[model samples]
Target: MQSSLPPPSRGRGRATRERSTVPRSVSAHQEAVRSLLQAPLSAAGPAAELPLARARGLVLARDVTAPVSLPPFANSQMDGFAVRSADLAAGRPLPVAEPVPAGADPGPLRPGWAAPVMTGAKMPAGADAVVPVERADPPRFPDASAAAEVLLPQTAPGTYVREPGSDIAAGARALPAGTVLGPAQLGLLAALGLTTAPVRDAPAPRVLLVATGDEVVAPGTALPEGKIFDANGTILHAALAEAGVEVVDGGLVPDDPGVLRQLIREYAPSVDLVLTTGGVSMGAYEVVRQAMADQPVDFLSVAMQPGGPQGIGTVDGTAFLGFPGNPVSALVSFEMFLRPALSELRGLPQPRPVVRARLAERTDSPPNKHQVRRGVYAEGTVRLVGGPGSHLVSALAASNALVHIPEGRGAVEAGEDVTAWLL
Candidate 1:
């Protein structure tokens, strides 16, 4: 959703529009968005001690030290006979003392006696090695009362033994603060015998997502003449949900200012943020500007391509942000200005992996505006996806990275390095 006041259209698009003043830099507007999110994020409250099941996808609030060593005691790594290296003299037959099942502790191994231990069973005292059940002569464990003698091959010390603290030592920092707990990370905690973890408690904030404009209609419906299916709503809803937001979809709002205002009024009080796409530019039918004329919304032009028209401030006492109506523009606006801010507030879904890659082909960009071109970054190079048109929604879908062409760089040659945010 591109506003009427868009950046200079590069690569097969229209010429640049004249502006009243130099637009704000992308970094400057990013700082502004950060400031905007602080209020809602702070209201989310403090740290929480959560069970492992509920801690996944949440950032760790504090470092977790191992309370107990992994493999706390010496345990058998295989089903074997617990034997002392000194006991295996010339492969002599030794009487089987007893069988140790998984949990029961076999007291110390008697001298010249063999104890059959199951896998994961704790080893007995005075036993420095183990001979597997297959290798021991007779190859089977007899009853504890039956007198069955076994012969064990000569083996090295600590054979088939799981030494204490081999995986991780006690009191060691297993996971540090700010680590996002996933299944693997939680498994590590479980291995350390922890039932719970301390994580940064971030509430799922409610967001009112508004998709405006008369030309836009919901998907699955036949588009009338001069109308298209709404992409902004779907795009924004998925992005919000990915960041762990409780999205209240406002549906398709026509170009009527009254209708949009009523929708905002109905949902704004219940939500932490009011996010809208479409109708923010200075065009004649800019319904967002029309609706928020009396409200405290600062509609301004940002120095960024695909999405340039920006609006930030409050509407009816609710924090708000308005993006352009073009589908690609809306997505770019989110990735650039909104996503990072939300991630900072509630660390979920993780941040975009950023990398520097060489350009796969020569490309042109606007003189002073920041540009985000959808690209396919493979190996060590990135190739542009589509021309620099905000309306190229299909092209955006095919991209795996957003190649960032910073302000002041005009024409870039092949092999030149550029920053790309992996999608």
Candidate 2:
């Protein structure tokens, strides 16, 4: 049975034509995405206290202050003899006192003696310098029981001593807000004996994903005649998960406008975003396009290949983005537009790293549209992975980078520099 669709509103098709007549530049579309997100999502949320292990890759919501000075107390930076600099002035052999092993607390140094100290061991009171073991007259740590007098070269005070607060002062800021908690940042917190971190309250944006196509079926199920297994859902699910988005699968919707509209209306209230694959282009069975024909959504054809058809609108006040059905096109649209916009809105780091690299082979690109080609980038060189085809899912998997051939440039010669985004 066919479902009735709303009549197209005035200026809807004209808007699409006007947008398609002049292909939207990559930067322009990205700007539009950014403009749609006026403020960060965390602004409306509360900060969360997460354990250090769970805080990795999250932005800090507040400054982390050191509870105590780094190194806590004065300690030896090397395995040597902790002695008064005055004792080494005359080049006289000072009798070694008790040895200070790591985690051990020894008494103050004697008037004319030295104390053997291990690396990271606390320096005894009255000790002004540490003579490295190799610099001692015996060039070794003496036996604890034996009467060992080790001559030491004259050393300056504070030499080889890791003074308290050298790395970080107590109550001082160890990390500032908005800092992404990477390994070094987490290590700093760990060194300060912190078990948890106050991270930005950027909760994962819940998304409702709808794959619309009568010929598309879920994987692992028996394929009906003239039907293809759905890849857009799988691709988008994994991508959204990697981007830290909570996805509520809306399953597959057929080419029925009423069913699609009902699904959007059902999930829009609980989701921050709605994403659909297919039914956004200028086709007869474009159910999503027809359902939103009277709505605020604008469906247009972008100038780029593999992902030219695009739709961005709001369904029931929830942001909606419609991508092409091809696996590679859907994935590319997310990376090129949605991901960066979401990152800005959610305080997440930009997922794709863009870098310039020399092309390894000559390649041609269509004029007047930015061609994004999958490639293998290695050691400052980028080679095309496969032919330019939106259905080449395997090729996209084999590639590690996306090479951008700019508009107005038809062909790029080998060894020429081009911009690439690292996956």
Each model's TM-score, in the order given?
Answer: 0.81, 0.81
- Residue 245's lDDT within candidate 2 is 82
**lDDT top scorer:** 1
| Worst window of 10 by summed lDDT in candidate 2 | 1-10
List model 2 lDDT by residue over 1-423, tens digit each.
001111212222323412355666666666655654443243536689999999997888878889999989999999999999988888789998999999998888988899999999999999989989999898999888788889889999999999999999999999987788999999999999999999876667888999999989999999999999999999999999888789999999999999999999998988888899998887779888887876677777777877998887677777778898889999999988788777766665566777889999999999978799999999999999998899998999999998888777899999999888889
Per-residue accuracy of model 1 over 317-382 as CA lDDT, tens digit each: 888899999999999999887887787766444468888899999999998988899999999899
Error of 1 at 1 (Å): 24
| Model 1 spans > 4 angstroms off | 1-20, 78-101, 109-118, 126-161, 200-202, 347-350, 378-381
